[model samples]
Target: MRQGLILVVFAALLPVVAASFLQGQSALEDARKLAFERMIGTASAVAERQRDPFVIGQHLLLVHATNPDVTDMTDTCDAALRASLSSYPPITNIARTAADGTVRCSAIAFAGNINLAQEGWWQRGVSAKGMTITKAPIYGRIAKRDVLFLILPLRSGDGRQNGTLTAAIDVNYLRRALHDAGARNAGTLAIVTRDGKVVTDSNNALAFKPAMGAEPDQPIEARDKDGTMWIYTLHKIYSSDLFVVYAEPRAQLMATAVAQMRAGMLLPLISILLASIAIWVGTNRLALTWLRELQNMSARFAKGDFKGDQARFERAPEEIAAFSADLHIMADVIDRRNTDLTQALEAKSQLTREVHHRVKNNLQIINSLLTLQSGRVREGAAKEVLAQTRARISALALIHRLLYEQDNGYDRGEVAIDNLMAELCLQLRSARRSMFQVELTCHARNFPVPVDYAVPLTLFVVEAVTNAFRHAFPAGTRGAVHLNLDLQAGDAILEISDNGIGYSVTDEAGQMGTELMRGFATQVEGNLSIISSEGAGTQVILKFPLPNMSITNAPPLGSVPAF
Candidate 1:
């Protein structure tokens, strides 16, 4: 209860804290906007100043290019290059290159005769018709330090390239200027190239580092290494592929928010504390104990133990008492219905057993009459047909006997398939004991067979067995007949084979038994195959789908001579 109240108090205080925090963020944003504008202006002014030295050098080269008398490339441009270098000290060197890949003039006297045709700066300048700036500062082969190149192509009278004029500007000069501006404004500044390279930063050590998360066209806010909030703004430099970054840190940004929220919530916090105490005491005395007991009772109800005689809810609130009474009424109704349903199920089971018993008795009487008629006939095909018919009838009668002996008649009474086949084979073998000495081996899996499936299944096996008994072996011949019934992959397989005189598979005569076996198989949606040879034994196989409860109609119990 105390934990819940504490959480409630925390939830109530959230909006106040959030409002104060948003207010402080607003102030920081305003300050950042002003700082970003100032930094951008500073960067623009610095970029213009940095371009001056290169512009002066290029102007000096343009003067000589327009003069007609100054046809000699090196001698005419040497003095001008020296004069420009002396004026702007940041420009380390200046050079004029001829069309034949020769550095014709230089501010340094010994810098002549250096070939610059293969350099990236020379290639780009010769192709560019106007002023071009290097995308990245390059290390000068002669200057031995990083330098930025500003190239101006020298065009002749026909606007064709004659040679190139190049100025090497010191990178340190721009870095120092940016550092001074950052120190004065209490922020950091960096110049980044378009390809995410930080060329220089306010701290001299951060050169060539990966650029921070600043898009070239917008401003973003983030935190620095010391958890100080900083806003970064990006400004693209005019006439160049470089971006200038301005970052300002608001050291006490969140601290002011936290302090304001604490001061404003002083009265609210005390009031919440007193209210929480009163709520705790009142709910404890009025509802908490009874509510806990009610929760336990609900748990018991969910588990089907709805007898709530032990619940002491009379002293609780009127609503709680009324709810308890309703629960008790529902439980009483459920209990009485359960008892009445059990008694009805018992009565229905007894009636079903009695019905199956009478059916078995009537089937046995039919089998007895067939037996008496077979005995009166001479030993010929007529008597043999009666005997086979009687065997089939007896097989159907055995199914009902098994169903009558079941413990549960309402659960669609199941029979063990292996046990059923074993008992059937034993009875069939005993009936033919005097005719021939035969052994019937039954192999099957034990599976719960529903009554509907059992009826058709038993009749199908009976036809196959009797067919083999009549045709496979002759009179007074001892032979072994094997029966294998197994359940595999949701199909029932019944196989019968006999080591007796075989017949030709091509012979189509005496097909009545074959047709009868086929009909029984089709009734169960099964397939039948027979293999017979002139001298070898015969084998019969029947494959059918597993028995299900869909066979509501009882199977034909009499002989199937016409199939």
Candidate 2:
């Protein structure tokens, strides 16, 4: 029942847990979308800002190219160019190169023996109809710094190219502009050429290059050369060859989404845990506690102990209280029944003991009558018969005496075979003539047999021992008799042997004592064997199935010695 309650709680909470998981997933996706939009917007804004300096430099160069002093290379042309360079910090130098590669007007003096005739930018600018910018930055020979040149073609009246007016934009100045733009953003920023060369970056340690086949305004994830993951988007900065890349670390980009997911799930998980704990405690208090008390009471009742406090269940739920009441009533009924059975058993045992006492008295009276009759008999054979009958009667009376004397509660109707045999051997020894000098010894294992089998068993032992005392030894002969009772496997074995003048079984086949022993053996459902040979001891063996009774002080197997 407790398990069922817990399962019910889980069943109710399962939907909440599933909904929480789905809600967390939705929250994470929404956070990702919002983060992507912000990243794209930042990339676009930074791209525009980065393009500003290049646009201003281009316009300045275009205005200066149309100036008469600069176009005619007059004496004031170098002074005008130097004044323009001082006004704009982004421009490193301004110069005019003739079609044949001669430096005519300059803002900064040329370094080395430099000529622009073979330069790729100058060659492309001379034949171009309008201004052109270099695809990548180059080291300026005149300014002695990395720069990108904006070149304007000097044309004749017929539109043929004559010379070029050029202004070098400092790469470091553009890098500074990009850094300022990046300061307001949360991610790194970089400008890269179409060929994947980095022109400037807010952070140089990060290889913030554009991804292959990346579309403008679309975000993509890529790993840098150092294996750091980044989420970045690209934007074109005024030209096809140059692009601005805005990127953030993937972990940083997803941090908000992860936090939102965790928050979304936390409440439901806590709710389930708290609910389960409540159910566990509530069930134990309302039902399980009383059930446990009832279970303990039932166990006590099974052990015949009905003394548990019935008031313990008074505060329980109605059904449990009713159950406890019924259980207590049943225990009372069983207790009363047990008391009645105990009283009846005591009365029956008392009656059985009384009956055995009366039977023992009657047998003792018969033995006494036989003893007195044997004294008056004249014939020796008749007296012998009377004595034997008296001995048999004595054995029966001994059995009855043992039954009447039994005080232990267990198996009062049974006689301890060991005690019976020991006393029987004593009686046999006492009855023998003193001149015979027969040493009688009895060794028996301690197990009880019911009175029905005990009667025949005792009679069998008495008759066998008496025959050995009466006929096995001659007058004035010294001999010994041994009686043994043993249990082997599930069979009881009783053996009586005597060292006396042995008799032939063929001659004693119809003897009264032998016939009586055989009849007694049959009564106890046993097999009897008489082993006798002239000049050898006589042995009588009786094997029977042991009664179903516990044995005490039983000797180990094979303890009986060979005669």
Q: lDDT winner among the candidates?
A: 2
Location of the lowest summed lDDT over 10 successive residues in candidate 1: 554-563
Taken over the whole model, the C-alpha lDDT of each candidate is 0.69, 0.81
| Per-residue C-alpha lDDT of model 1 across residues 1-563, encoded as one tens digit per residue | 76687678768866765665566566655655655566566656655655565566566656655644332574556776676667676778777778755777777676435787888767887789777767678887656679777777777778767777777778887788778766765557777766657767786333223344455444466665656566556666635456676665544323454455455555466666776887788677667877788788878877778787645887888877787788778877876787788788777777777787788888899989988888899998899788878888888878777777865233468776766787788778776776557667777666667876677778777766776677667877777778877656778788888787877755664377678778877877888999988668788898988766332233322111110
Query: Candidate 2 residues 1-563, lDDT tens each?
Result: 75776678778878988888899999888888999999888878877777776787777778877888988789998888888777677788889877677788799865555678988878887787777778788998888899988888887677766698888888998788778877777788888877777877885444546674678888798888888899988888866767887889988999988987887788777877787788788889998898899899999998989876779888999999999999988888888999999999988878888887898899899989888888899968888788878888888888888887855322357787777777777676666656347878778887788888888988887789888888888888888988888878899888899899998887743288888889999988899998999889799999999877777765653232312
Q: How many Å off is the CA of 90 in candidate 2?
A: 7.3
For every candidate, C-alpha RMSD to the true structure in Å = 20.5, 4.8
TM-score (all chains, Cα) for each model: 0.47, 0.80
> How much lDDT does candidate 2 score?
0.81
